[model samples]
Target: MLGKTASDNRVFVYEVAGVRQNTDNDKNSYPFRSSSSVFIKVPYQRMNDEMRRITRMGGTILSIKPWTSNNGSGEQSNDGD
Candidate 1:
């Protein structure tokens, strides 16, 4: 029962709504919806960087939660791969 806790190294999933591919700066371009919920497995250390990147891209994070496995067993682990 001795292992790294969920908070030790967590991955968050950013549920971003209204994500457009093209920006308004584009000349006479029609922006398209990229995805409804972009599941980005961001590492604990890169959370800020990812948030910045998402904001820069005009994405509004609707919700953020720790990444989990499909079966809801526990936090998903990235074994350097």
Candidate 2:
């Protein structure tokens, strides 16, 4: 969970789209299809950095919200864009 601190207890989820594998990605030892959307668990403190990184990677940020369960059935608060 991101953004879990002594004072702040909120965790965030980042919904990213159009992330393609590049040379920077070491996981791509072989060819594979890129998923259109990716769900990233980001902490509040690192949100800005993560957003910047995502942008540099040519990914679009669809939405950002508070962390919920794996199924995303928990409460959702759109605190980040």
Candidate 3:
């Protein structure tokens, strides 16, 4: 098996919605408030796991994009947009 290298440390951002405040999310200090959506940082190694977890929590995965540093914010880099 090809071992992961430093170059494979890419991170992606997942924009999810419909994750309501529930018993599962009550442990979070900043619990989900009534909102349209939220952005979650997911590492390359944890994409599938995060997806499954989000699905189990009744959250819909809206968009998944490679995360890039925009100044100090982690966002999708789009030159044209």
Per-candidate clash tally = 0, 2, 0
Better of 2 and 3 by TM-score: 3
Screening candidate 3 with a backbone cut-off below 3 angstroms (N, C-alpha, C), the clashing residue pairs are none
* Backbone clash pairs in model 1 (N, Cα, C under 3 Å; residues 3+ apart or in different chains), count: 0
Model 3 lDDT tens row, 1-81: 999897477878888889776676677655356677877777877788888877877999999987777624633222211
Each prediction's RMSD to truth: 8.0, 7.2, 7.1
lDDT of 1 by residue, 22-69 (tens): 553243233343556555566776778767766866778887786766
TM-score of each: 0.57, 0.63, 0.74
The local distance difference test score of each candidate is 0.59, 0.66, 0.72
Full ranking by TM-score? 3, 2, 1
Candidate 1 lDDT for residue 36: 64
TM-score of 1: 0.57
TM-score of 2: 0.63
Q: What are the per-residue Cα lDDT tens digits for candidate 2 across 3-24?
A: 6465265577788888766654
Residue 52 C-alpha lDDT in model 1: 73
Off by over 4 Å in 3: 1-7, 71-81
Candidate 1 regions exceeding 4 Å error are 1-8, 22-33, 71-81
Q: Which is the leading candidate under lDDT? A: 3
